[model samples]
Target: MQGLDEQPVQAHNIDGFVFLYSEAQQKRYLSSRKNLLGHERVLEQAMESGYRTLLPLQFGLVIHDWESVREQLTVPKENDLKQLFAKLEGYREVSVKVLWDQSSELEQLMQENAALQAERDRLEGKNLSMDQIVKIGQAIERAIAARKQAIIGAIQETLNPLAIEVIENDPLGEDMIYNTAYLIPWDTEPHFSEQVEALDRQFDSRLRIRYNHLTAPFNFAQLS
Candidate 1:
């Protein structure tokens, strides 16, 4: 929550939401990661702090000097940062990861994927053409893609009503369907988490729903 260089790394309070970052090292050593205490910890500290609102900087962001921090945070981008901060002042951020069990999902999919199975059976004979095989492969890929979209879509539909904003993050692994961050009002966090807990129970059989961490509105502010 506090230094990029040898100095202390406390995040600056800019209108309750914007936090300016200074320069960091070119290489990331274990020592440096330890110095920053890892991104999650830093973010957690900021959110838990007494600040009315705090904007998180992206991982490994740095400027050449303190001058850059002051300049970029204050006068840069025609003060769009300030405007964004003002817009985000009363909200906070939370991480929610939705992971499906590939084996279980795959099993369910296969039972429902008769066309894909038919294509596979069609390819078994040595008489198959290369173009046919390629087409079958593409078909399989399309089926999987469709299933993933369906699963993530249902999840999004379940939560979208509660979120002020939601940003999709890159999936962490093959089983990850959605790695999302939500912008929620500070007072509404309990209801948000309650909904997540219900989702966890509902998806217990096939998906792992993790309500990860609270942090500054990094995703909402487009910090990463």
Candidate 2:
């Protein structure tokens, strides 16, 4: 493990637990995006160090010394931390993102809905006013949202039984149909992945499904 300036990360044993840390001036690592990469690197290394369970600190924590580390972070929160660790044992976090071809979906919607087909027909080969175009666009947006929600619900239902917990995040763009995180027992990860693969094959033409192979349970951490 290495620090922001490439200094080796060292471990300090305090009150029966080991804290992995590196020597650095507190101000140097605060509020700087570049330094955040270094902070994440140290955490990533620690998380991959074969520990069965961990409680990760939020980024930008600026404990000045080992004494401060113990008194401020570990000592007071020891019991709660232990509980969190126990609860998180044997589980891991993974995320799935689903993207659809918007044009293809919209075309299907238009084909299925007579009202939408009529609206499109009304605009065909016409010098339509901006208001008319805007109204039609809004109607299409509503239809897309409704269809997207239904698909998300269906997918979640298919995957929920395999997970210990499910978290839904807002979709980022028009192409994104669903964004979600799942917490599952470590042993079930392979099976969870197989289900995701089946979903990919199920939506082979219209959607793309992706899942993270390694993650730190950031979503579950908040709950714990």
Candidate 3:
């Protein structure tokens, strides 16, 4: 297999388990996006090579030798590894990110709340103090946060049934309503996708849902 440096990655069998690896400087893995993607490609290739079940190491892990790898997989821990493989068998992850138009949502909020409208009217065309502006900004921030929580809750309620496990990742920015990864059986993907499509249609004007399907179960398979 070709790895981060496009060098040969050899496979070693240790107690009935296979470890595919390539020798490289640790700094290479930390260098750039290209190396990161290349590392991920190596893992994807390993899984695609008729070994459907895989537990990925933490990114940038540099085990110096075969003995280190062997020691990491030995004895009682080996049973745990096998159980993890069995648990993840026939499963993949689907990642979904929901983004909302902030300006649009704020406009809707402004139209809906009479008190907020009155507050805005009070401050309009006035030479305001910095304290007054800061308070107004804080109120707007709170309003945005509350709306995001409600929408995200509704999304999770709709999609949770189809997934074996749902992981809520930290939202990246102000416009992101939620970022989540779902662990699901391969057979259930069609139904899961249909639900996502239905949601997209439901919120088409205000929100955009980004759905990525059939990805490796990285979120679910974190190892120390």
**All candidates in order of lDDT, best leading:** 3, 2, 1
Local distance difference test scores for all models: 0.70, 0.80, 0.82
| TM-score, candidate number 1 | 0.73
Q: What's the true lDDT of residue 196 in model 1? A: 82
Best prediction by TM-score: 3
lDDT of each residue in 1-224, candidate 1, tens digit only: 34444444554544343554534565553446565466556556555766646555556654555557666665465367666768788787788888877777656766888877766776686687889878877877777789888767777887777888888889998888889988878788888888888877876677788785477676677531
Q: Taking the candidates one at a time, how many backbone clashes does each contain?
A: 5, 0, 0
TM-score, cand. 2 = 0.81
Runs of candidate 3 exceeding 4 Å displacement: 25-28, 48-50, 128-135
Clashing pairs in 2: none
What global local distance difference test value does model 1 have? Answer: 0.70
* Per-model root-mean-square deviation over C-alphas: 4.3, 3.1, 2.6
How would you encode candidate 3's per-residue C-alpha lDDT over 1-224 as one tens digit per residue?
78766789887788888877777754536747887788778877766676667877766777766677677664547878787888899987889999988889999999987888789889999999999999988998898789888888778888998888999999889888789999888778899999999888887778989998756678987643
Candidate 1: the clashing residue pairs are 2-9, 2-10, 3-9, 22-63, 23-63
Q: What is the TM-score of each candidate against the true structure?
A: 0.73, 0.81, 0.85
Against the true structure, candidate 3 has what lDDT? 0.82
